[model samples]
Target: MQIINARLRHQAALHSLTMVDGRFTAIQAQSGPLAPQSGQYDAQGLLACAPFIEPHIHLDAALTAGEPNWNQSGTLFEGIERWAERKPLLSEADIRRRVHETLELLIGQGVQHVRTHADISDPSLVGLKTLCALRDELKEKIHLQVVAFPQEGLLSYEGGLALMEEAIEVGADVIGGIPHFEYTRELGVASMQQVIALAVKHDKLVDVHCDETDDGQSRFLEVLAYETLKAGLGPRVTASHTTAMHSYDNAYCSKLFRLLKRADLNFIACPTESIHLQGRFDSYPKRRGVTRVKELDKAGLNVCLGQDSIFDPWYSLGNGKLLRTLDFGLHICQMMGHQDFSRALDFITDHSARTLQIADYGIAVGNPGNLILLDGEDDYSVLRRQGDVRLSVRQGQIIAQRPAAPLLTPPWLSA
Candidate 1:
């Protein structure tokens, strides 16, 4: 198969890809008078780039907003309480339907990689079971990585170890923890240690909700970095939503960056959730409940963006669209320059694949033939207009294609 006149992500000139047997065999310049091949796709100079990746999302509590009641208080605690109420009402069929629906929406937007954190704190373990099954169900179009996430805490919550072990034994790809939610700081450290040990034991990855708060005193990130570095596991560790880092003094953060860079840990920040759920307790200068994304990027550390919720208890607004995630990420992170906007797309694309550790994922000569063509000339145009995905190719086949939506026309308002 030959794909012609596709805009390159790394250059201005148009290029073509030769795909054979579900992999790109060659990428060369489109400077030929040769006749069109039998199996060829003319992109018409559209934007062609790597498939999008969703590095951090909660598939268990997705699309469950206002099940019993809404998060009226607008606090993380209230959201957790509301989710607990809805936990008992979960059934395999119910969870499967919503998750699959969300995945469809993601695929339409050109996302093919997702790392969803499913709750394992429930004694019934219904969420973990449902997501693990969904992993197998959605592998054809999307790569789903399920994390055995203890939403409450490992040490504070009862039967947490057993639940995590069960999740790992039943095919969890990662282990997750929330240290800030623990009852005490000491317990939080213990929980991080437990999660790291579990990851080592099961040979899985670690993605913890580390210090997701406004309190500057939280120091769980240091612990995670130290452990990951000591164990010689650098990129295998991910710290999601280190919001407290936003409040840290430069002195502390400067020191922290040393450990983070040495360990080469990945950072995943949710801009939508951070802007909404944080700063509720402050009065004068409300802090954004987000991490230092630009700083991390400048430090040469891997940083990715995420849509933490999609019409869920924690956040009421989400479309599961990675473009929206990138929009908020650029706005909240204050990365609005020309180069900033161009690289901001990586927050959901290349940088995210690194966070999830997706192998051979990009528009390369020898990479898999999983790519998307959107309606734009460059990353800036595609992101500013939120262009439609013209084509979605998976494994050397066109799985989905969408045309440009028609502009509304009336007799009086016709253009």
Candidate 2:
């Protein structure tokens, strides 16, 4: 398969890429018009880049907004309470349908790599088992990494630790915990310790929901980072939704940044949901419930963006597009400078690939034939217009395509 007249990042000249046996075999500049050949895909000078990665999302809770009752308060706690009401009604078929539909939405948007959290606090472990099964079933089309997430609390909830262990035993690829959501600060600290220990024991990666609150004192991020550093997990550890850092004093954050850098931690900021679910208790001079993304990037720390929720109890909106998240994140993080905009796409692409530890990602020789052609010339154009994905190719095969929306103009206007 050949992709002709595609614009790759950091390359001015149009290039053609070849894929053989599901691996990129060649990439060369298109010198001039050449004889048309069979098995060729004409990109028409569209921006061709690696597929988007969703590093943090809740698959089990996706598309479940207002299942039993609406979260009128619009708070994270309210969403959790509503989810509790809906949990008992879950069935394998119900979860499978919703998750598969969500994945389809993501895939249509050119997202091929996803790291989803499966709520493992259920006594039945239904979410974990279901997601694990889907991970195997969808291996060909998507890379699904399942995190055994204890959504409730690892120590506060009954038999929570046991369920978390069982989830890892039953094919979970990553270990997850909600430290701030624990009953107390001590339990939160313990939860982080337990999650890291479990991950080290099982040789799995750790992604904790750390400090996802607006309280200036939600200090679980420091504890999680300390645990990651102590365990020597380093890059294998991710701290998702460190929104509390938005409220931390400069003095403390200045000190915390050093620890985070030493720990070599990866961070995920879910702009859409965090902005929606956080700062609910604030009145005048309300705060933005997002992490310090621009600062993190400037500090040489890896930070990525995530959609976080799509019609879930926590956030009642989304269409599975990371670009939408990027747009919101860029505005919220004040990352509108020229250099920042040039590298803004990395928040959803390369940075996320690193967080997920996708070894063979991106468009290069010998890498998997996974790339998306966006309907734009550059990242700014694509992002500003929220461009459509012209084609989504996975393993040398086109998996999805969206036709450009036609514009109609009067004859006088056209002339």
**What is the C-alpha local distance difference test score of each model?**
0.88, 0.91
What TM-score does each of the candidates earn? 0.96, 0.98
> Whole-model lDDT for model 2 versus the true structure?
0.91
Q: List the residue pairs that clash in candidate 2.
A: none
Candidate no. 1 TM-score: 0.96
Q: What C-alpha root-mean-square deviation, in Å, does candidate 1 show against the real structure? A: 1.8
How many clashes does the backbone of model 1 have? 0
Checking candidate 1 for backbone clashes, the offending pairs are: none
**Model 1 Cα lDDT, one tens digit per residue, 1-415:** 7889888775788888878899999888867434456778888888888888889999888899999889998788789999999998999998988898888888888888999999987887888888988899768878999998999888888888888888898999999999888899999988888888888887899999999988999999999999899887789999999999999999999899999999999999999998888888999788877899989998999999989889888998888788888888888888889998776678888888888888998988789998999878888888898877889898888877998788878888865
How do the residues 78-160 of candidate 2 rate in per-residue lDDT, one tens digit apiece? 99999999999898999999999999999999999999999888999998899999999999999999999888899999999
lDDT, candidate 2, at 337:
79
